[model samples]
Target chain A: MAPQGPRRGPVRDGAGRAGRPRPGSRRCAVTQRLAPRWLEAETFDCRDAFVETLVALASEDPRIVGVVNDSVGSSKLDAFRTAFPDRLVNVGIAEQDMVGMAAGLAGGGRIPFVSGAACFLTARAMEQIKVDAAYSRNNLKLCGMSPGVAYGELGPTHHSIEDVAWLRALDQLVVVVPADPVETAAAIRWAAAYEGPVFVRVSRTPVPQVHPADHTFTPGRATVLHEGDDVTLVSNGTVLWRALAAAEQLAAEGIGARVLSMASVSPLDTAAVVQAARETGALVTAEESVPRGGLGGAVAEAVVAHHPVPVRMLGVDAFAPTGSAGYLLDRYGMSPEGIARAARELLHRRRS
Target chain B: MPSTLSHAHLTLTRAPRPPAGAPRDEVVAQLRETARQIRLQDLALVHFAGAGHIGGDFSAVDVLTVLYGAVLDVAPDRVDDPERDRFVLSKGHVAGSYYVTLAAYGFLPVEQLATFLKPLSTLGGHPNRLHVPGVEASTGPLGHGLPIAVGQALAARLDSSPRQTYVLTGDGEMQEGSNWEAMMSASHYGLDNLTVVVDRNGLQQGASTEASMDLAPLADKARAFGFAVSEVDGHDHGALLDLLGSRERPGGRPRFVIAHTHKGHPISFMSDQVAWHHKVPDADQYATARAELDALAPAAGGAL
Candidate 1:
């Protein structure tokens, strides 16, 4: 149903590779060292960080409980179930029931963190999430694990590309996608403490450490990792590091680029987006999601409303063909070179 | 809120309780009268509002009255008590019935009945926990309530509170796959404190349940799903209270009560009639149904 949305301006295939820069593209200052060529060898799974932070928080607060749809192993809740055996409620493959149960549990004065695969949790039980959690304003945390095509070999059915767009459209739900382990841990802590419905996308695909150990996540706030003026590169979740690499490539070519990590997608960091649009003049958005209603859509809305600017959105725009997660991202124009090329294109559009 | 109550209705609800240690027969008689009154008020709500699921409302009334009147350990005053028994109306389209029951019991003001289905009324086609005070969960979509009830029952157990959890679902609503899922968990957890009541009316909208989707042998299905199951006459106040309030609930098992009922029950010409599923009665039909309910009213001196 989504593939048929009327495209704006031209009928370009959503995933068509119209602009690709060769490897010999102009050398930027930090391209080789930071553009994933020297990609850090260390990788930490955010799901583990999620469990660690949840266990610590649950220990401090008795109201915290874990709810799952037979995802104890997949959602990394085995340790949680062991730590607080009775507190973990596994409903066994019923996503709708799992969400509704969480709503009822929250209504009963217990803080429930509902965890499951992002694909099923968002699509299979969307109505429950909309009415029971968001409309009712229940104190619940929806931990969407292994989000954004983390299950690469399993194909499109397992991909959570539509989660941000689907959930962001529903009011009262705060959509969050942590860029790395540190942000993932911080985001988990924040959602557990907040007193309303929240969807925290906790990834399974490992990424290098990005934020500080002490970094505290605040909702609706974006972190500016690198400051520049020529163009703003907005990204989050599994693709943020690749965007960081894209910025390094831009820097090596003497193209100053601002990088904004937009973890909060629903109640987005509008002020930051507007500032980037006005100060930087052009932008490119890289996300591990569809080009619609995600980081790209949110930034475009904010920019058009406050300050109009040429925006190039680089993300998965169609059903991914069979490939590993990294291969799929590169094929969908989410690679460092791809993002850098999109940034250059956005600058050229601004010049025109 | 319903603001159209006559003076007799206002005076009748002045006493919130009968004397403590009241005779069982006397309490059951009072409950029957209250259930009759719930039917009458819901009928009026449908007539005045020009819309409601009256068939389901009438079928579930006796069971609901028995719970709010005799079984549930709750008060309008203690609605927020963490230890209080939780009652969720899973068949929520019949909210008019539940609202008046709450009003009759003083959980909601009686005058609020006039506001039902009005523009921007708190009472819509379905219950909303946010807008309504006593509704535990807002349910319209079938199969949502039992799972939530399972969660509530689980929560009570975690607190080690003796607070019981009760949820009422329509017979036809059992077709939703979610109820069976909840049934599995209710038994898996050995939730002895939870009781699920199915208003086994023979009809849903547009057709008999048997014709729509046969859900017969429901008791055995529930048993297989891990619940100790029983069937009762839904309109029999004494039978409903006895089965629902029984303290002999076995260990490590949830209780399922199948209250056999007829859609638009007891109202001659409407009983078991499929058209009344959500039909708003005209002047003549309302008068006939209202007269039947008035005749069933407890003799003024019999009980409270």
Candidate 2:
């Protein structure tokens, strides 16, 4: 089955001109046609991106390794295992031990990317992440595959919406939520090169390419995808494409909305946030995570600390009901229309 | 039976003066003096900081002294050398004592001790690798160091390096499930390069280890988890050094040393008492404790 369009490309170049198709562009065609109306071609299922990135990175760096907790299939690493048999270490279903083992491998001079379902990786082995990677200052990359409402139909137990919030609270950890495949690949390359601890969230839901291929991802910098003078739409992870589409829709209504791809949630780009607040007047932050401590809360924290501005946060307020990721995102008011409505409301508040 | 006794005596007499050709007497004496100085520094830092687990510091000071003064293959200038042995103080709340020991052994400057726990000082309440020199990892939360040490040991094994990895944990910290998880993995991987020393002071924050959580028959548990268990008097520098220096048991398994000790070892009033666990000694108590430690002369020993 071909992935849908709009989510993938013939992606728009930095100059906004539609260009040649990238290698993974075909997958998005299937998602675009099969996905619900609100989701576009740019939105991508993260499982595919994770496996693809891992396989590519392993080919480039022999020392690159994968540590999973019986999540080989769930984390979409079958191809990775087939490609590099000895590189993928499956430590059964023990999350804590899996993380510890990754730390051990890192100590042995291997760059270990620990991939697991977010809920277990963040909650079950939180202590190990805190001590082994963060505290020990080991060069470990923790890849949380299928995070946020990506597992929406499986119910709240499997949902990883709280991962960003929980991980961001820890000191000395770099928290990243890549906006799309381009950003995901960029984040992976940066994480491999960057020393020390990092938490990268890979979504199961599809998202459009919000940034250009040349987009350089700095640890604490937010990328402004579109420039406008009205309300700013800030988001990360799977919700970023929705924010961008919402910005497009808002532009039609004569509202000049700026869309920002907030890839790094921790050590947040405070200057960008403050500038967005001052220049844009109002802001609407969206994410597939909770409205608390995720992107919304982080932006709010930065804004309030330095630049106070009217802001509306859009996310899952409570545990999502059993439904597809699309249904849950729409039901929770994270669809393009919902985000556009939020931007309008925030603009109204700013005027009032 | 008589022949066995004679053989044992002959082995004891020919023990080769502590490994690495160090004279046993001199090593013991230097370690003892180092222990006293560490204790004094611990007391001073705790008093100045107004916060420290003093009792636990006292309990584990001898172990730190021996490791820094003799057993471990580490030095200040060559601290980051990958082939050098690694020491992780898992019981991080007693960071004051660890810092003092590091300073005395030239891993860090003794003058830095004065800035401990003060604002902007690298010597935090816990050992943070980013701030403190020679501190391998940040460890205040219990049960964390062993896993990292296990990783470092595994790293050494992979590289075919002879360097060993040692981690010191509080007996109470064993309650955390992560420790057992690491232990199982360590043994499964046959990490003979790893050594875990539990400061079995028998007391925790609220009460005794027995009252808090019974870890009695701790050695049996370690054995079951595929470790060579060594029960030693934690405060006895010679005993700690000897056990830490010996080769692993016949099987290539991780080693666990349960160092039995008092919460406050030497001070008459503080020893074995839980109240002094983190309580700073007042003027009178401080003077008495100082005099007690000062009266004991340094034992004689050669370098490891």
Candidate 3:
């Protein structure tokens, strides 16, 4: 059977782009339109965004609860616990038990948002996510905190570069990676209201807002951050800002590039991908995760299926060396300069 | 002691079925009829599907019949009620028995029994909660149901709801690490609202649990896990009901019942045979087994 509610048309922007249309565009249609509208100087971290949004949601609905694995301090949920002490369930350091307990809580009529380090939450509790949450169709919202190389210098064991790839392999799971605090808040609200299982990566690293304050968040839809026609630079998570910067650099070199913030990686926006292939002729995908089975792989799969176009995938190929998050990104060729160079090379190859 | 008083006290204290308000003889007769029908349905389903863990199904059929027939406070009408007690068939490969038990108890229609393991039937090889009405969880990979049951038990305690949670796992399935993890959590939480029934059928897929990974002194191990341990004949309906309904310990520790059972109970050729784990019965053997089960009238006393 089809999904429960009225089906939405394929999300497209004013210029007939992939995401919600621009302010005045006729394709900017949605059921609920209360998008985030934050000021430029209104700086907020993702942790702050998570706590503020959760507390507000809890106040409105008593069923909202937080399930953690003794990472309350790391997840910045101490304030949330103080506000709703009984609502926060800490299941010690056992990740499997934590996810299973969340499923149980959801079974008992509670909407549990399970938070923990992304590395363990995705790998350790993968079976639970597949069986209990997705297979059983439980209404559990999994918030993977501090994903990617945010735990830089701690080595590969601490980094969560495989979370996206791992979670993307599971069917019936909505994989989302919000670019900034506004997107994070919007994604959280969307998850609470959505009636299915969702896995959202909450980055610890800071990033500037790339979406408009009234930017709407929808599962399986891509957002066009900057409009260009020469080539498309697609990315999500912290790497989205880097992709936008790369697009600007490409524009400086007189190479117009379309930037797409690909938040939902599983049910990828194939129409936008095909449009980019037909209009732009080349594609470049960037992410703070492994290129294998992640955004790059997802995009490649879509391109090969319907539209075959030259594509450049940017991500860490091997276990990261010890360094800061920025240093690691630059070292792994994830910086704006690195991405721009890669896009330029792809465009050159396309001409040749 | 009269069986009436014994069954009455069992219902009064720990039985999950509707109270034994009916006449004692009537209750006994109902239990007998339910058990027989469940066996017949289970045998027919396994023969029709051409694939089933028939040995385990036959071994656990009596316990399931007793629970649904006269022990659980659940009915077809109240299946989705939050207050109804929950049963998780952890050993889900024996789904033929569970399907038949649920069907006989009116959780589903009897005609649906023919559709077991069909392409579009909800009766899959394993119990899937999304498809099955009374299944609490989808369990095929072992050791999953215990933790979920623990979670439900903890939820019951938190909500101050009197609904109890019961999970039945094969003796061999306990070797998974997840079961130990759940056991630790269940004890740590002091969940007296949960009962774990271990179908000690001895044989696993390849060999007996003892020969493969010995769980000898199983009762002591449960006690070490902070549970009130009880050992009984799994095929005896009265013994199974009484043991399943025992009171919790003073400290609110969880309960564990190690039910000693043959792999294929009441079947002369299949009982206690290791190869019968999932072996389908042939025509000749099937006829003999059906005759044996059909001849099994209600035991004169609690001696079955």
Candidate 4:
């Protein structure tokens, strides 16, 4: 049931472009329809997309350098090192130095992409991220690889579920989590061209290409995958693919659920969130990370202040038990069926 | 006075540079007088602001004086040069001395010293590179600057630039694990253009560093970290100049000069006293300390 949007205006003058999808208008074509029959075969890892794009960008821009903390193989930077031997600086297993030296390299008029494991890169070097990159407003791209439980049974110590929450609170930082290979490559090109601090997830987890080959990624914006009114589902990174799948399942059940794929976490698309609250009357956010903060927290804040709506967040809330990547996704109720079930439950809360 | 995001309005009273090789003895005497003046100014700023780390500031000021005056290819005009020498103040709690030394080098106006710690004054407790011309990094956090200096050294090599990078850290500051981490790659990269000077001021914040964490036998420690280690009386200008000469010894890893000094040196009462660490002196102590420094200093020819 598509309810009339609430009349309440924005809390701040710049809540960004209203999150509500205009009548029959779509920002991203990928959101307009389901996956075509021809697009069923090969999948691409976002990390591979990131390295290919980075190498291409580095060739034209002399300033681009890759700074890694002994994760050349994990981050897929061996090719980068071979291409630009002097440009790749392996700081030898020091995450703190990896980040700090990236800031220093920026200070010396070079653009450095500091890459490593998401867990160690974000948590181990948070202070450097805060002071050197964010507070000091240095131009450095922090590429976090194999985020979420992408490490599978490598355990909680390797889990980067807290990165979104930790980084989104910092000032002058842009946080983006691309859904698939096309968007991942697009996001890398954007981060490198854009000056100032940017944190992007270069995930090793493979997923079907969500965006078309030419589709571009924009910061502080959301791509409306499907426009519906019964409820809204929001997600990004690997979970966005599941979110889209969830919408398709809900559509089959005659529950018209809208789906929004958010790339930017810090400069969150409040307008779209407000629109989701007003039009859908309920919202369900699913991220691969923690239940709090992440995309859910950003959406909830918008919903509560501007247009109050019933919201249910889907993600791992506690320390995840040992399991493979696929098992963890299904175990934590992050599969398409589970997400669709959450959306139906939220719609119940809305209709009642 | 609001310190609101603008360049310092005050002008330099005099160009704070030495004449071309005046005489070895004269330059030493001028530098000694300059060092003494910097000490008194540091004390005054601390007294004015009612806050400072005067102990390490005093311990490090002489090392800063000799470097700014005799060493370092940086001048206010050449600050934009790609090949200019880079100096990072790793012991950044001593902003009073660093600021005063910057002033003495004409990098900042001598009058800007009055804004020390005042609200909105760019003269913050720590040096911010964005706020000052000569400041290479925004540092207050202890272990950060050494690593930044290592990156700069690496950058110089990448650029094939002849500029040398020098970083000054406290002996107590060496306890920060990041310092050792930076030192490992510094030699691994074979950075002969890098020289790290340890202001071996025996005091840390609360107690003597020997009692606090005991970074004793500091020279052996540097040599072990792949440095061509040297030791000098930190207060002696001539000996320091000799050690800091501009030369890259072929296959020499990196130079680590441990300039032995006492916290609050030359101030008889405050000397070696841990209480002087960030403690602003009272009027009587200030007057006595100034008098002691003034007796040795000649007419403050160069005061930042």
Candidate 5:
């Protein structure tokens, strides 16, 4: 349900604008680029990088197998099925059975990557994911493809906005949301090598490359995309680049905003969040999810527990009207300029 | 674990096993005696713990004894072997029976039955594979174990291992949609190394299964779902040994065995009784059931 008050704060027309260069910001000094590399023209789907990395990892490890609930095409696993036909166990359209079978396969010493639509895979068989995989400590990988509101106009039933909240609550499950193609590939590879249950959100919406090609993912580590001291913008998933853009815009206006890409949601990088809270004294969280229980909720929890700050959260707070993914995101105040506006408001609140 | 043996440990020890290469009749006799002793121990567990699914436990005892005694190739030492046969108790409300059965097979220490259902005990109301040594999966909820078993079967096939996978479900539990989903994939993959046994005890928690949801013609339903279906007397140790131990997978499909059993089987007052599904017997009822089991044979208390 959407709140009745001015929960969205103020609207700024320039917020939806894609990219604005910050040549005078600390990002330019750190990465040796005039603007953040994520502002480039080309955008890439994280699913492509997911499948490519999976195939490369599967070639070296025979224990790696793909389990799908009839999502070979939707999960972009056609090449994986072709290459490893027998290894790909397609339990057609049964999410419960698919997750249980993945645990069973892991019990028999085969690593199973269960891929399906983020909505059905997380909600439909949540009990199986909890008891069989997380509670039992089964070495399984659950790839939630097209996570968050990436389904766009397909309706909220198909949107997995609550997946991070649901999965991170499980005891032994590792929840991860990769920001871009390079990070997605690295997270998949890292999950494959880790000896435990992992739920990695693979986004279908296109995003520009955020990390360098040589980036290696470490669990529970947050990347500081832009160095600033006025306010911290903690974001992940498809909304990460937008947060970076918001920081660039804030930098152009002489208000430094620190951008932290918090990909690991469960074993959250609380140290980085605490550092940001103590240094900046104000924080704003943005995600491609509900405003209350996803990334925004996580950062708020970490901040209040370790170092309290004036935290502002931005996300899809209600069932969106019929619109494209970009439109819905902008309407929900997750656009770059909208995030900058929220940060400015939070900064003003702290000043007063 | 607690060391003091409660009354639940009355005459608890390893169940008698048939000698290696024993004749069919001898094996059947030993299995029957073991089942009777396991029933006695299971009864004590419920009576002492003051709670259990005693009805389902009694109905599943004969089948469980037959598996551990003669059918399965599992051993306490080889619990972690990847190629070992896998057994999952899908009807996990009967953890009392499962725990005693594991104890009787030396998979767990016999004295540990004292801690069953106790506070901070490893043996909770349901089987947790993490806590128990021989348990393959921690299953409590209905319709969960079969899918896990099916996946295990698929993994064995992928590895080209001859290890067989088995799961036991309560007849009432068949109404859950997940079991049907698993059956579809098990049949679709032609998983010949899998066996699914249903404790067709005709009773759910509150009513007869037929009145709750008719599973009449269950064999036909399983057949439609791609299993080679058969029916047997669940308590008949001889028959259970033959059908479940049969390596033959006709048509190269998964096997579904419907063991026609009565809830709270063999005990006159409890047999086929709906109220006894999870009822804890009082002192008088407990004494009567214990006497009924002990009189079955002279060596009914963990002796052959």
Candidate 6:
């Protein structure tokens, strides 16, 4: 099946979380009236896009299979289980088994997408993912559901802020953080066709569409969302839209902030990051994860290695307090105003 | 499974053929000789390399000999056969015996055993499927192979293929909860094509399995997990062949054979000794061990 275009629809509760506010029905207080056009557009749960694309791909390819650790309702694989009952193997609540089994499935000439909550999936089965999938070069695709603090108020135990830092260290695994529903579908389709190890961080956080209707995912490539010359705001996943909104805010304040949606974290788009640093002179990175060893660390590693430029990273620093996902993101200086402030600080530090 | 045959690109120069259609007594005799040859080669490799789990290697060689020598439908020339029977050595510390067994079966050159743990050698402390053909999974960490074998069995069932998937895990490795999780999955799916053979040597690194984690009711545990459990003398080639070859999976459940074995089998000093788990034998010990292994088949030493 050819990849399908973006579907603009209501948040279908792919995560089965009740009482989630509809996109555009409620807006963050910091950017309430100043929300950009993209922020006001209809939003979607990327998990829905993930499953939709996975089902479509499975329909065409008999080799594609789904392996989960009893995360059917949470990972939104109920439809996939219904469609291909035998293809979906649920190793009940066993993350290590789930990943190892996926590697085995790949060894048996099946493309297995192992899905689970990012917290247990990465931390629990990390050795399996490292040995079976990465070092062994098994063609396994790992889908980390509800990554990067998407499970808010559930405490730090459930937060997946350390996933990127943990997974990007593996050599052969391609870690991708798709920005929106369209990009999520595109990444799934790409992973299905690609014949190697891949780890795609799929978020359940409802966010407005950031990519276009025909967005295509390329591994290790960045999509330049906004053009500027003064500074660059590099981000992806749920934080990319906020970075875009921050760029718009910076533009209003006579600051040219280029926004680069860096979805691939492992095989990072170092070329784009180097170009952004060379052209803009200063860069600010925002993510829904920790700045250290996450996107910020990756960007800083690239910039310091390739281009010598001052970079300000925006992300959660400490274990979060009690709050919702949006509140945690804002409290950690990830809001549009906060991101713009980070860029301004970079500029000021450079001037001083 | 794709018919395009995507395998690790290797220039394997396999030795010529011998058919396995011999009678029962002759087949068992051949398996014993094969085990003896592998043990002798593995003993020398471990002694020369100065590092290897000789205990576990010796414990697993008979089972490995039975599988590759007589049971499994894998061939050195057809390593990429999708319908071929799959075998995963989960207790990967004994890669010495594994590599020797593969070489004995002509998967690779028998002379390559000299490069067991040399610098830049493909033969690492653990078996890697990328560099070695006929290795189904690259396993070193405990509790990994069962789940992978479960996945392979699940894939076979999904394809509606008649291929069998087998995994050999250490009795001590049964302490890993992941093994139990995989057993649950295997039994839940009723994967009759999957067979799990536990190397029930009753020993681990620093202590016995019972003293470490107590898997005493191991067969009962597997039975409760919905497996058709069977206990066999691991070194008895005739019993291992009968149990592993044509055993029935009662009620279409998965097979879990508990192969009772000693830490170092048929070796006087090292047998059932915990200190020999990974201990490199000194010159005196090596001579004695080599001489003892040599007596198993006096004329077979020149085969490799």
Expressed as tens digits, the lDDT of each residue in A96-198 for candidate 3 is: 7777767776766778899998999999988999998888888889999888887777778989999999889988889898887778888888999988789
Q: Which residue pairs of candidate 3 clash?
A: A13-A21, A36-A213, B16-B71, B16-B72, B16-B73, B17-B71, B17-B72, B17-B73
Model 6 scores a TM of 0.93
Error of 2 at B222 (Å): 1.4
Over the true interface, candidate 3 deviates by an RMSD, in Å, of: 1.4
User: Tens digits of per-residue lDDT for model 5 on A82-195?
Assistant: 888888999999999999989889989999999999999999999999999999999999999988778777878888888888888899999999988889998999999999
Model 6 residue runs over 4 Å out of place are: A1-28, A36-39, B1-20, B298-304
The per-model DockQ list reads: 0.67, 0.36, 0.41, 0.53, 0.81, 0.72
> What global local distance difference test value does model 5 have?
0.86
Candidate 1 lDDT score at position B195: 92
Q: Estimated TM-score per prediction?
A: 0.91, 0.85, 0.88, 0.89, 0.92, 0.93
Docking class of 3: acceptable
| Candidate 6: tens digits of C-alpha lDDT, residues A196-287 | 89999888876778788888889889999999999999999988988998899889889999999999998999999999999999999999
TM-score of 3: 0.88
Return the lDDT, model 5, position A233.
96
Candidate 4 TM-score versus the reference: 0.89
For model 5 chain A, the run of ten residues with the poorest summed lDDT: A1-10
What's the number of clashes in each of the models? 11, 36, 8, 3, 1, 0
What value does the lDDT take at residue A137 in candidate 3? 82
Where in model 5 is the C-alpha error above 4 Å?
Answer: A1-39, B1-8, B299-304
Q: Kindly indicate the candidate among 4 and 5 with the higher DockQ.
A: 5
DockQ of 4: 0.53
| lDDT per residue (tens digit) for residues B1-304 in model 5 | 1233375356766866677779998888888888888888888888888889999999999999999999887999999999899999999999999998999999988888888899999989999998999999888888999999999999999999999999999999999899999999999999989999999999999899999999888999999998999999999988999999787777679999999998898999999999999899888898899888877875544232
Tens digits of per-residue lDDT, candidate 3, B269-295, equal 889998888887766776787677767
Best by TM-score: 6
Model 1 regions lying over 4 Å from their true place: A1-38, B1-15, B300-304
Candidate 3 local lDDT, residue A30: 17
